[model samples]
Target: MGFFNMLLSLAAKGAVILFFLLLLAFLGYCLYIKRIHMKYDHIPGPPRHSFFLGHSPTFLQVMKEGKIIHDKFREWSEEYGPVYRTNVLHFVFICVTCPEATKEILMSPKYPKDKFLYKRLFNLFGQRFLGNGLVTAVDHDLWYKQRRIMDPAFSSLYLRGLMGTFNERAEKLMNKLSDIADSGTEAKMLHLVNCVTLDVIAKIAFGVDLDLLTNKSPFPEAIETCLKGMVFYIRDTLFEFNPKNRPFINEVKEACRLLRTTGARWIQDRKTAMQNGEDVPKDILTQIIKAASKEENMSKEDDEFMLDNFVTFFIAGQETTANQLGFCIMELARHPEILEKAKKEVDDVIGMKQEITYDDLGQLIYLSQVLKEVLRIYPTAPGTSRDVVEDMVIDGIHVPGGCTAFFSSYVTGRMEKFFKDPLTFDPERFHPDAPKPYYCYFPFALGPRSCLGQNFAQMEAKVVMAKLIQRFDFTLLPGETFEVLDTGTLRPKSGVLCSVRHRKYSK
Candidate 1:
């Protein structure tokens, strides 16, 4: 009986020891997290994580709610200083909003966007075609090299040459709309406009006119596949956020698989034409070909890589430009005065009877200001990132190595301190020699990685807007707002629906 009691006592003691050990383990983790949290404790931000999970669950929750994580960051930015930290997954994410910090990040030769996941996703799209094209596809040194090679293609003179593509597509789109409006009188503007933009991008970027606006289902198969293919990627990325002994990294051997398979076929076809010494129409793709041909290092193996750029250009230029048009047009439909101002400027310059020319559109300064304002409010490309190359101090916060930082034009656009009324769609804010908005309102971004197609894009927008407003006066069909689906570009949450009427401008 005494021996049995001794065994029971021993077991009780062991149980107590086990409980204390578990408690200590938990306490240590708490202290580690607490120490890190306190490092930024004095800095204004949202509530720190209550546990080690930090902002991971919040990010997934935000995604589940179909909202952008940046929206939450914008709210936090109002209270926090220009630079603040938010724990995103295991990351101590730093967001910089001030102009100085923005310039430091964007213009720095060292900082590049952290595109680890995007690189893999892009590779799935086609690694070869996008191997070195701008925007997350290239490393910093390659980006600089690619930028230098591509700059001449978008020179003022080159941009002038591309204006006809916009004018041509806009005319076709207008006529198509006229036919539609004659029959139905009103239609969803999003898809039709997107089709036109894609066609235009295809033409300007590569000189291959798919005529997507007129074609019934040109990019249908590829677009569908590309869209669906991204799901596997998003799923795989979220899976990596778990810290509990997750193993394996996928080296997507086909960085340009789809792109190469499909894109290379086109590149091969184009090369054959060039091999026969045929005149490929002068487009951005042709320009790239010219550069490659001139490049001593370029080889047949590089064709897939070059074609990746064309695909990237197609996705990048077309997608963003299309969304911006929808957003701006929606804003115009909502605010009659803004639309009228745009119309007046167009009419004043081109005068209702004249065909809008690229050169003529440039003379319409007030119209340009309106577009600038639109870009500022609903920029095509919203937020961007920069990974700190070395230890750096941003906004007095000393960031350590491997820290990724960011600035959102989307967020900056809404800051009360940035603009008098940041949310309002007032074009006059961009009058020539306009009072500058603290250099923080970067829509196309600035320096180094600024949108390569800005000049071409602006030309396209000017022509499209001029022709569009002249032809149709749209009313937002009562009780409709263009919802937000902010991503690489901003878009209508539920599509910009409107009642369209053909405008007859009286002389």
Candidate 2:
């Protein structure tokens, strides 16, 4: 009985020790968070909702309310000036909407992409998605090398050569839309544009013929699922743990696998073709393989990097352009006057022409303005972020180092300070006589790391848009709100549903 009592007493003492240890750890964590909070105390921002979670709860509330997170940033920008700080958990993000700050941050290579953010993009739902691709590569040297290798494929001369492919793919879309128009059926313009862009990227970049408009392919759905998964995975830290999210998460993983596997098969085919001395187009895929061919035998890591670029080009090349076209259509449909003017321009420049040439693209000046205005309003790839490793003063406000600096075109483009009547969609803002927006307008982003496919995307977009306006007259279906959906990239929330009718001059 004495020994039993002693054992109980010892166990009680051990429990007390463990409890104290946990208490000490908690106290230490609180002190660390306090230090971080003190570090950014000078920057103006909304009040934190939680001592530990920082602004994360507020962000969650915004998401729950079905609003784009960037719109919240814009709201905060209005309240707290152009440059303000936001805390997501313990991480500090200095949101800069002013043109001066935008120029300083984006135009220089000194600020690399935020590793914290890009690393999250390296995988989605624990599946490798963009593993060290040109987009996700944080290392400047690595990105530069890959960019150099891929530059030839995007050269002005090379892109000029791709006009034929663009016309061919876009013509397929017209065929599909014609079917919808004939039956008087409503069409999802976003889906149709997505297929055309997918077909274009497959043909021009990888030299594959997906013919997505003609063939029902899993790729479109897979791409959509992966994009949706990317939003959930990147925004919510605990996304994978929730039982409710399991089914969607599984689909995301499967979608990622499909893209990577497809990339692998296509890559192997190209390599085999090269081995057999068969003629293969000198395309982006060829450059991707060349980028990783420094070693006699490619390592597993090299092979994965090749796949990373394959997925990156496919998603980035296809998704952003399609979203832009969808939003452009949405806006044009909303304003019949603007649609009429744009159609007139297309009719004059590309009348009765089966093919839209590179020279013809340059002559579509008003249409170019319309497309530019669309991006200003709905920058499909909304923003870019940089890691601020050194302290600096932005707009005379002291911003501390060791924070992420985010430059959003969406916020800046809509600000009253940057553009008059920011909410009004005015194509005249991009007129040749209008003074150019300093650094406030970057739909394709600005700087050394600007989208490599900016011209390619725009060229493809103009062809599709010109043909679309020339051939069909479309009206937004009733009940469409034209809300922007932020699924990684911005897209029309209602899928840009529209009813189409063949124009009198279509033939």
Candidate 3:
């Protein structure tokens, strides 16, 4: 009886201690929020979050079940205000949602790019070849120089020339889809996109032909493995204390090593083909070689960096485009009216033509708007970040140096003040007279550091959408809601399944 009484006493003490700790944590959070609010009390945001977790766990839970974080963020904004702070794993994330604040901070040189997560990829992995490529590197003169080196390849004339590549591959994609459509088979929709995007980038970036539509080879699988490779590092963020994480870091290194070896081989073969009087293709590799020859310092670095560029572009380029295209399709499939409107626009412009030429695409204003609208709804990336080099003030809020600044086109695109009927899929919102979405709806980002492949990605989407719509009218099957999966970019967590019927043009 005495021992039992002792045990009960211990349990009661443990419970009381836990309750006290919880109370103290709550008090700390209230104090922190109160302090932040007192100074910037006029600012806006959600209610006070947990001491360390902030609203991340709640938002992450919603996203895990296929809901968008933007919806919750906007709700908080309406209640709290546009500019507010939320903590994540002990880090307070200050969000600038007001359009004017977004412009002031993102465009300001004082607010710099943060290397928190992205740097681990390059500094830790085999990305040493980037030698200051746009995505991973800092915004410096050298970054600009390297960016300029690759710009001409994406220029109007160059992109127009690349249309032939897009056509051949897109037809292959249509034929593959038709086979599945005829047989009533539905594989992961994302898989088909990955294949086409790989084929597209292989041709455009490396000047190689990978008939991914037909090729069931391991090489493409290996290439895709390299692209899906980031999942391990991301997983590390969740289970940081796990000792197994080291193996993952090593695994990435080994993967990069293998990718680098294959890339070097491809480059050698391409160079040899060009040297032996063999007719070489006009593609991204050739463009890079030409640029390197003209530039003063692009070639002075270690050959591994150059070859790393090959692997980086080949893998990263394909994945980024694939993610964007997948999200676009997801949005279109969710909103059939928007899809039909786009189809109608395409039909009116090209008139049921089987082939979509560069010139034919030029007249697709509404089609272009549909693509833009999809991008706005689901940006290819969640947001871009910058580390403040010096103290900066956005709307009177002092952002101290060394603090990270994240500019979310994802969040900005959905802001109520920036977009009317923000959730609606109205492509007309992109028309000239429609309120301009300069800083508001930037999916490809803006300013000097914008996506170099914007034109290429647009052309790819336009061509693919036109061909698919011209051949097939798409509708969401029985029961499927368009949900955003915010991973590398906003993609459909579950593959978007649709019932596609051949276009008969009723009108």
Query: Which one is best on lDDT?
Result: 2
lDDT of 3 by residue, 1-507 (tens): 999999999999999999999999988977775564454334345655454455656665664665666666666666656656654553445665666766766666555556665565563344342334567656566456666767777789888888788888888988888887787766455678788988888877787777877777455555544444453343234533567665655654566666677778888887788778788778887776667667765454534455756766766666666776666776777777887887778878878666788888888988888878777777766677666566566666665554455567777677667787778878888885787776776776666666778788888888887888788756655666666665545666666776655667666
* Candidate with the larger TM-score of 1 and 2: 2
Over 4 Å off in model 3, which ranges?
1-80, 86-93, 108-111, 123-131, 217-241, 244-255, 275-277, 297-302, 505-507
Better of 2 and 3 by TM-score: 2
TM-score of each: 0.84, 0.94, 0.80
Candidate 3: worst 10 consecutive residues by lDDT? 231-240
Model 2 Cα lDDT, one tens digit per residue, 1-507: 999999999999999999999999999988988898999978999998888877877777777788888899899999999789877666888999878888888999999999878999899878999989889999998788677767877889988988889899999999999999999999999988999999999988899999987788899899999998888777777779999999999999999999999999999999999889899987778866665575455578767777898999999999999999999999999999999999899988998889999999999999999999999989999988999989989988998889999988899888999899998999999999999999988988789899999999999999999999999999999999979888879999999999999998534
Q: What are the Cα lDDT values of the candidates?
A: 0.70, 0.90, 0.68
Off by over 4 Å in 2: 1-23, 291-299
Provide the global lDDT of candidate 2 against the true structure.
0.90
Q: What is the lDDT of residue 412 in candidate 3?
A: 68
Clashing pairs in 1: 123-255, 126-256, 127-255, 127-256, 128-305, 129-307, 129-308, 129-309, 130-308, 483-493
User: Candidate 3 at residue 205, lDDT?
Assistant: 78
Show model 1 residue runs off by greater than 4 Å: 1-44, 48-53, 115-121, 124-132, 218-236, 239-260, 299-301
lDDT-superior candidate, 1 or 2: 2
lDDT tens digits, residue span 140-233, model 1: 7666656666777889888877767788888888888788778866667777678888888877776666776667753534543443344334
